[model samples]
Structures are given as C-alpha cells and as structure tokens.
Target chain A: MISFLQIDLPALLVGTLAALVCALIGNFLMLTRQSMLGDAMGHVVLPGIVIAFMIAASTATWVMLTGAFAAALFASLLVEFLRRSAGVEPSAALGAVFTAMFALGVLLLEQSGVARTSFDVHHILFGNIETAIWPAATGLSSLFDANALANLPPQVARLGFGLFIVALIVILLFKELRVVSFDPVFARTIGISPRLIGAIVVALAALAAVVSLSATGVILLVAMMVCPPATARMLTDDLKTQVLLSLAFALASGLLGYAIAVLLPLGLGYEISLGAAGTIAVVAGVFQLIAMIAGPKRGSPRNA
Target chain B: MTEFREILAVLLLQAGYNTTVVMLGAAALGAATGTVGVFAMLRRRALVADAVAHATLPGVALGFITAVALGFSGKSLPFLLAGSALTAVLSALCIQWIVTHTRLNEDTAIASVLATFFALGVVLLTVIQTLKTGGQAGLDVYLLGATAGMLRSEAITLAAFSFIAAAVVAAFFKELTLVSFDTEYARAHGFPVRVLDLLVLALVLAVIVIGLRVVGLVLIVALLIIPPAAARFWTNHASRMTIVSAIIGAASAYGGAALSAVRPDTPTGPVIVLLAFAILLVSVCFGSARGLVIRALGTQKLPRRVS
Candidate 1:
C-alpha cells in the first residue's frame, strides 16, 4: 500500500490530469471539426521541446513547456498560411506541416547527439510516466503536507494548471464557442469574430497538448484529445452534457487503465507491468467502441 | 573535401553495392508514394494516410511476436510488413466506418484511430521487451529507419513493392484522375467511385508498407504529402503534376539516402523527409504554376481595372 502511494498514485494523478485537460479542450475541437489540429499540435510539440533543449541546454520543465507551446503555435500558423496563401487543401497542409516538423525534430535529435544522453526518440514517444514516483510521500497525510506537495512530479502541476486554464476558457467563452462551433456565419453576424475565437481555441488546444505531453506522450495525448470527446459525442446531442460526460469518461479511463496496467500482470502472476499511457488509450478506445455500437445518439438522421 | 567526394560517389551509385541498392530502393518508394499522394490530396484524404501510417506500429510488433512464435526469425521483413499492411487497411476501414456510421467527422475518426492504434503498438512493444525475445532489438529500426544495416534482399523487396504500386497507379491513371477531380460526376457517369477511392487508399497502404523500411512509418506520410504538395506548385494538369511529384519524391529519397550513407550517424527516415521538405520550400518560392514568386509577379504585371 505504501509502495502504491509512492509510485502508482502520482502516475495515476498525472495521467488523469492530462486526460481531463485534453478531453476538456477536445470537446471544443470536436465541435469545431478541428480534431486534426490537436493531432498536429501533438506532433509539432516534439520540435518545440527539442529546440528548447538545444537552446537552454536544460531539461527544466518550464523551458521545454514554453518551447513546445511556441512550436505548436508556429505550426498552427504555418498550417493556416499554407491553406490561405499556398492554395493547399486544409488536410494536406496540416499533414505536410506537422510531419515535416516531426522529421526535423528527429533529425535534430540525431545530429545534436541528444539521443545519446538525457533523451531519445523512444522517451519522446512513450514518456516517463513510470518514473514519476513521489518518493517524498509517506502516506495519505503526505497529500496535505507542503513538502510533499512541493515535491510532486512536475507533470502533475503542469497538467493541473493546464486544466484550470482550459476550464476557465470554456467557462468564460461558452456562448461564443457554441455559436462559432454551430454557426460561424451566425457568430460573425452577431459581432463575434469567429476567427479570433478559433485562434483562442487553437491556442488553448496547444496549451493542453504541450502540458499533457510529458505524461501521456505523443500517441496517448492525441488519443485523449480525441477519444473521450468522441465517445461522449456518440452518446449525447447536448453540448453541456457532452462536455461533462467526456470529462467523466476521461477520468474513468485514466483510473481504470492505470489499475489494469498494474493489476493484470500481478493477477497473471507476472512481475512485468503494462504501459500506463497505452493502457489508458486502449481503455478510452474501448469506451469509444462501446459508445459507437450502443449509444442513444449513435445514428445519423438519415440512418435513423 | 573527402566528405564531399564520398557524398558525390554515393549519389552516383559508385559508393558500393549495398549503398546503391538502398538508395535505389528509397527512390522507388518515394516515387510510388508521391504518385499516389496526388490522388489522396485531391480526394482530401492526405491526413487519413497519416492515420494509416501510424496504425502500422501494432502490426509490426504483432508480426514480430508471431514470427518468433512460429519458429521463424523474428527479424523477417516480410512478416513484419505483412502485419503492418493488415493493420493499415484495418485503420483505414475504421476511419471510413466511423465517418459513415457515427456522428463523428472524418478528422476525429482519423485522429482517434491513429492514436489508439499507435498506443496499442507501443503497448505491444513493451510486451515484446518483457518477453526477452532475441533479435527484438531490430524492431526499433522500423520506428525511425536505419538503412545502414539493411540487407540486400530487403532492399530488393522494397524496390519490387514500390514498382508494383507505381505501375498500378499508371494503369489506373485516367480513372483515378476522373474520380479525384469530380467524384459526384464520376458516379453520375456510372463509374465505380467507391472502388476507385479504395484503390487509391490501397495504393497508399502499399507505399506505406514498403516505405516503412526506408522512411519509417512516422514520416512515411511526408513522402506521400511533401512531394505531391511541392508538385502542385509546378503544374495544374494532373498527369504533369503526377510526373513532377514522382521526380521530386525520387530525387529527395535518393539524395537523403545517399547523404545518410555518407554520414551514418544520421537516421535515414528524417533525412529523407527533411530533404523532401527542402524541395517543397524551394518549389513554394520559385515554381512556375502557383509559386509565390510567380503569383506575386503575375499580380504586379496585371493592369488595374479601369471601371
């Protein structure tokens, strides 16, 4: 139990926080039909962190996080530029920009010899969730202890801050977001600039992606940004209910996935543990699959 | 000076048999992907190819584990690629299914499937690590591509698959062009638009599977995207664009592979993509059809309306 408090608890907290933040922003992304932007942000964050590391020569959390946020913002702007100026199709522009950035990140990782120490491609992809142990925590009392709180994993704090920002944005701009998502033309007629709102939403998504990246890794970050909201979308037509359901689903996936990752191996009499992020993604996918098959709102009007 | 000479030698195929084979294979894969990419971009399924490319991870891992289970060397490229092909097709189908059956849009489906499949692949990889299978170390090469250790047979297989994919594109050129340009019109004319769409996706899958060894799955979509996107700046005619895209793709792959051969420390996949991106950047600036320079100059030369 003590081992669980030190090791499993922090990992679970970080993973759940990452999931909640991603799912929170993901609801708007799905409604706006810009889910792929979340995917693009996930890929571009790699170069941001890599360049940050190159410049600062430090693995400090803030340095890398700032770098990631900048890269994501730059990549989003590049995608917009390519679409508007280059006459490229939106999907193609996004695909081209993100992949090129990712490739650049990988090349830099190799050429700078960063892959030899401190970080590598595998670490960037799978993340270090298992190492996010809270050695300072002694038991439940440590939860309220200032020293223990101060020593919490950096990812937990980052993701918590990200969740706060996302929830704040969603709350403050709920009406504008709904109007733009459902009818951008209507939003523009009503004096709301859909473009500005779109940019803010994209910026918020970038924040969510950058903050969640170190805990969830690239694949799980994308999954969390997509699967929970999609699953909720399948089950409900109401925006408010969908957002609430998605958060619940995200929390559920994180907890259930971490539990399974640790328990399944022990139950099978194997000492090896599964990947927490991967398992969470899988559990989220399972929820999505179930929703797809059985949700009340699963059918389109024509199909119904 | 010596490094320059070595790079030149590799480019000219005078480096050695191994280097020549690998470079040629990469070139073939590039041409195939670039050719197919034009249709995918036209159909607005460029990012869908990304989802499919990412989905190959689990297939590769599953293929390795199965190969070891069957008493074959787990490093067999054929088994691994075959596994990737299965999952790639499955992922594409899942995207199609979600778009058709659910309220979720194609982008959401694509992102979700890409992430979920990739995460599953990562989990399988962890499983492989724990299993302590011999030769499992080689599987990491599929993630980023390490052509420095590619075998002769593997290069031949890659070249052959690439050629077959390209030939299929040539055979269906007109039908594909028709469908991509005007899908509803093609359907009105009783053409099999659905089948043609599937064929384009299949061609994409073929390129991805073969290119997995050269560019790796992570950036293989760039081979399908960057070259065609660059080609778009040079030509408006579909046929001309396809040819131009193929050339750019082949050139980037050949150049990137040769450079990697000269400087073995650099991974092959990213170098290839970076080279493709460089070509894209150049084409964006100077190409004749829609290049920014041409557009800017053309607008300047236009007389102001004297209404």
Candidate 2:
C-alpha cells in the first residue's frame, strides 16, 4: 500500500492553506452576507488570468496573481457602480457582470489559444491538486533552503505566502472587519470609512480566490468561502467561535476530500483521477448538511 | 443585388439542416427562458437558475451512464434531458429547503447548491470518461454547448418543451403575478403559495433542460436572467415585461445563432449570453422607463407604476 504521507503531504498543505485563506475572509463574508461576491470573483478571475498571460507573454505565478487581483478589483468596482449609480439589484448586477466576464474569458481563450500556454481550462474549472507535491528529499523545514524551495511547485509557495499575508491583514484589521461587517453605518459613525474597509476585504477575498483557485477551482472556492462559515454559524452564535469552527471545518474538508480522491482509485484499482477539488467541495457540503440538521441551534433566516 | 440575395439565401434555408434546427431550438429556448425569467426576477431568485444549471451536470453524466448500461445509446438526448430535469427539480427544492430552514440567505444557499452539484458532476464526468464506450465526446457540450452537433429531432423536442412551458406560464400568470408581488397577501387571499411557487420552479427547470442543448450549463442561467431583467428597464407591468422579455430573448437567440453559424470558431452559447448582456447594457442606458440617460437628462415621462 502507498504510504499516506508520501503521496499527499504537499497536496494537504496546499488544501489546508487554501481552506485557511478562504475561512479567514469567509467568516466576515458570512457575517456581512457578501459570500456570493467571492463566487462572482471566482468566475471573473479567468479573464484576468488570461489577460495577464497574454500581456506578460508568460505564465509566471506573479503575473497570473496580479492579473487576478486587477480583475477582482475591476469586477467589484463595476458591481459597486451598478448598485450605487444605477438602480440595478445587487444580485442581478453580480450575476450579469460575472457571467459576461466569464463568457468573455472563454471567448478570449478560444480566440487567442493563449490560455493553453499556462492555464488548463479543465484545471481552472475544477482544479488539479494532485500535481502539488514535494520533490524528492524535500522537507517542510527545508522549504527555506534555496535548492528545496526551488524544487517546490511555485503555486504551493505562493499559497503559503498568501496565507501569511491574509493572516496579517486579519490580525491587524480584526476590529475594523468586525465593525464593518456588523454595521457599516455604525462604523462610519465611529470614524471609520466602511467603503475603504469593505473594499479591502473584497480585495482580500479576490486575492484569496486567486491563491485558492489553483488548488480548489472556481466553484469549489465559492463553496469553501460560504459553506464552512455558514455551517459554523449554525453551531455557534459567538463570532470568534464561528471563525475558529469555520477554519477547522475548512481544514477537515480539504484533508478529507484529498483522502477520498486518493484512496478511491487505489482501492478500486481504477485508472482514473477523480477531481480533488470537487471532492473537497462535496465533503464541505456534507459538513454543512450535517450542521444544518444537527447543530447547536435550529437555523432561521431571521438570525441571518 | 443577385450576390446579396444568394448570400442571404445561403444564410437562411439553404444552410445546413443541422444549423437551421439548432437555430430554431435556440430561438425557442431563448423565448421560453425570457418569459419564465420575468417571474424569477420578480421573485428575486435571479441567481437560483445558476444553481439549477450547475446541478444538472451530474444528472447528465448519470443519465449517459444509465442509458449505456440499460442497452440504449448513451447519447440519447431525451434520456440526458430527463436526468437533468430530475436533478434540477430536486436541487431547486434543496435550495428552497435551505432558504426556508436555515439562517443562511438565499445567495448562500444557492452558492452551496451550485458548487456542491458541480462537484458531484465533476466526479461523475470522470467516471463517464473512463467508460468502455466512446459516447462521452459530445457530453461536454453540456458544459459549453455543442451547437454543431444539434439535430432536427432534438430541436423539435426542445421547441415542444418551450411551447409547453410557455403555455403553463400563461395558464398560471394571474396567480404567479399575485404571489410574486405580495406573497403574504397572496397567502392571505387563499392562493396556494407553496404550490404556485413549486410550479414556477418546475417551469424554470423545464426551460433549463432545453437550454442545456443551446447554451449548456455554465451560461444557461443568463438566458433566463438577462432578457427579463432588460425588459424590466422598459416596463414595470408584469405582463408587458414578459412580452418584452420574450421578444428580446428571441431576437438575441436568433441573431446570436446566425452570427455563430457564420463564425466557425465562436461557440453558440457564449455568443448568445454576450448578446443578451449587450441588450441589457443598452436597456440600462436608453430604455424608456428607467434608462440612465433619461434619468440623467430629466426629460422623460415618469415611469407608470402598475400598483
């Protein structure tokens, strides 16, 4: 039998970091009812990534990440404009803008064939976590060593750095995030600009999505951003507990999903790579379903 | 003049039979989605169709596998559509269940369902890809649409479904509008609110089934959402909104399909969505009732509110 750690340590770390990044922002998103924006950003990030590739004429990780950030900022700005300036409903605006952007991305991908250089449409839609692995003799402590770090898949290292940045932002802006999430008007009265904070949070979510998308794909990223926190909320009323519970659930889902994807093929002796990110999404759904049915409190729309 | 006539003729009836059938199917699918979409928009479930669309993927894969196992051609359109219809209805109910039972907002519920269903689909598609038969080639069309593979029989089936959906909506128009605008009042007035609500869900699901052929799953909801939303800019009257939405839907469907026919590389579904998006943008800027330009200039007549 294949050793568990041998095949999946790097994949697990990547998933764990993705879950952590998503859970950090996902908590506030659930609190503020802005979870769906993550979904929209996930959809529209494709065009940004493709555009970045085209302009850079390379598929460097930084180029893709920057492209995704700009795209998220642009999409969120468009949504804000449509809602604030025009009279369009918020959900409709998000649906319209993201779908249009996603379709445009697909068209561009077809026309330019540039996406094939660095992006796989299949991998982008569902993700390819199996490819995240440590090279021979690479160890966690050795990640800092130049030879080992160079051997690391750049996406994994980027996710690690992303998690540190997100953790720092959350730590530094915890109170601001709480106030803005709970009551923007109250935040404004207390001398805080809710718009700036909200923008930062959205930017953070978009950036997290860029980092996570490589491992979890777009739809699964949406699932992670909403389901874990939403499920945690079903089990607790305390904000801190909700955040912690969400992080725990996110990590559990990533690990469990990876286990299922790896074991099923080996057990059945099948020649197939069941999508890892999708399995993680399914596992997260299972967690939410269990929470909704048997959590500490009965869920009601009023609480939301 | 003769050359222009010849070109026009070639573009229309003289085109390949598959093109004509697919175009007709596209038009019907568009009109039906637009008509049903008005109700979805009125009820503020603009993104619920997205959930329904994604939820159908697993069903399509399962349907293919089941058909093959049962000694039928796995590519049977009817079987695949049935599978989609079944899953779509079930998942729509699940979303409703989450919304009515949980503290999560409808958006969260929708996002969860959409993602979860798509996840299940990805798993099933992998299985389908590993099948012994070679019938999985066109199945991915349900992802981005395989308009070139559309045939006369499938188009006929789709058109019939659209007509049936339209008739059902027409039959329940009064009750639907009543419930849409004022659910509590409709309940107070003895409307079977739950029944009517499920009926609308069923109608949306039916249109989505036909839509899978034209636009596939990824962008199918746009067909339901964009045209009706654009129509809302022009009129507040629900009936008039439905009519305008259907017209916009048909126009975009026919026009987009024609353009795709000419441009060999352009997929029919995305082109259709982009066209609808363009129309919505135009409606936002210049529509008579709430056009931004009219509002900016302050020269247009006040929007006539039905209430």
| Strongest candidate by lDDT | 1
Cα lDDT for residue B198, candidate 2: 76
| Error at B82, model 1, angstroms | 1.5
Candidate 1 residue-pair clash tally: 0
DockQ for every model comes to 0.74, 0.59
Where model 2 places Cα greater than 4 Å from the true spot, the runs are A1-7, A133-145, A183-189, A298-304, B1-13, B182-189, B263-265, B300-307
After superposing candidate 1 on the true structure, give the runs of residues whose Cα lies further than 4 Å from its correct spot: A301-304, B304-307
CAPRI tier of model 1: medium
lDDT of 2 by residue, B81-164 (tens): 989988888898899899888787777788788888888998888777877788787787788765665778888888889988
> Which residue window of length 10 is worst by lDDT in model 2 chain A?
A1-10
* Structure candidate 2, residue pairs in collision: none
| Whole-model alpha-carbon lDDT for candidate 2 | 0.81
Residue B110 lDDT in model 1?
91
